[model samples]
Target: MTLTKPQDLSTEAIATLIGKNARVYTTGDMLTQDFVPNRVNIELSDTREIVRVWLG
Candidate 1:
């Protein structure tokens, strides 16, 4: 799925746009610094709201 404004979408909505191998996380969570070129990173707010979307 494609979004005109991904950061404005909900976590569940964005999750559906990604493949099964995507990475989903929220603020304050500890994550590895390693970068995987094909990985899709979805960052959510503390209240489980979608905040940002990007690829590695």
Candidate 2:
């Protein structure tokens, strides 16, 4: 649940570390089908945020 920890670097592992209460966002390239996440925003006492943009 604590994000400031060094061991919590991997964003994908957040689901297991915090359980279903956490929020996860995933995106992919339209042509390549390659998944990528650009930025992550976290609100106070709220779940995490993931912002993905396709640079076409």
Candidate 3:
């Protein structure tokens, strides 16, 4: 799915847009030890704003 640039989307919006099971990473949060490298990393800003969307 293609996301619009500079859109102020919330985590929920991003989750819904991508998928409920998609991996979400907020700023300062530690990466999961068992995290698998794939298309499921969604980075969010400090205010819970979507900053980046990952796809594999």
lDDT of candidates 1 onward, in order: 0.71, 0.35, 0.67
Best by lDDT: 1
The residue-by-residue lDDT of candidate 3 on 1-56, one tens digit each, is: 66555566555765688665466777778876664555467888876667777653
Candidate 2 stretches with Cα past 4 Å from truth are 1-5, 21-56
Q: How close is candidate 3 to the true structure, as a TM-score?
A: 0.47
RMSD of each: 5.9, 10.4, 5.3
Better structure of 1 and 2 per lDDT: 1
Weakest ten-residue segment in model 1 by summed lDDT: 5-14
Give the per-residue lDDT digits (tens) of candidate 2, residues 1-56.
Answer: 75553333244565456443333333332233433353332222122233432221
Prediction 2 TM-score vs. true: 0.22
lDDT of 1 by residue, 1-56 (tens): 66554355444655577644477888888989998887778788866566787787
Residue 48 in candidate 3 has what lDDT?
A: 61
Task: For each candidate, give its TM-score against the true structure.
Answer: 0.62, 0.22, 0.47
Q: Is candidate 1 or candidate 3 better by TM-score?
A: 1
| CA lDDT for candidate 1 | 0.71
Clashing pairs in 1: none
Question: How many pairs of residues in model 3 come into backbone collision?
Answer: 0
Error of 3 at 14 (Å): 5.3
Name model 3 segments beyond 4 Å from true.
1-20, 33-38
Among the numbered candidates, top TM-score falls to 1
- Provide backbone clash counts, one per model: 0, 0, 0
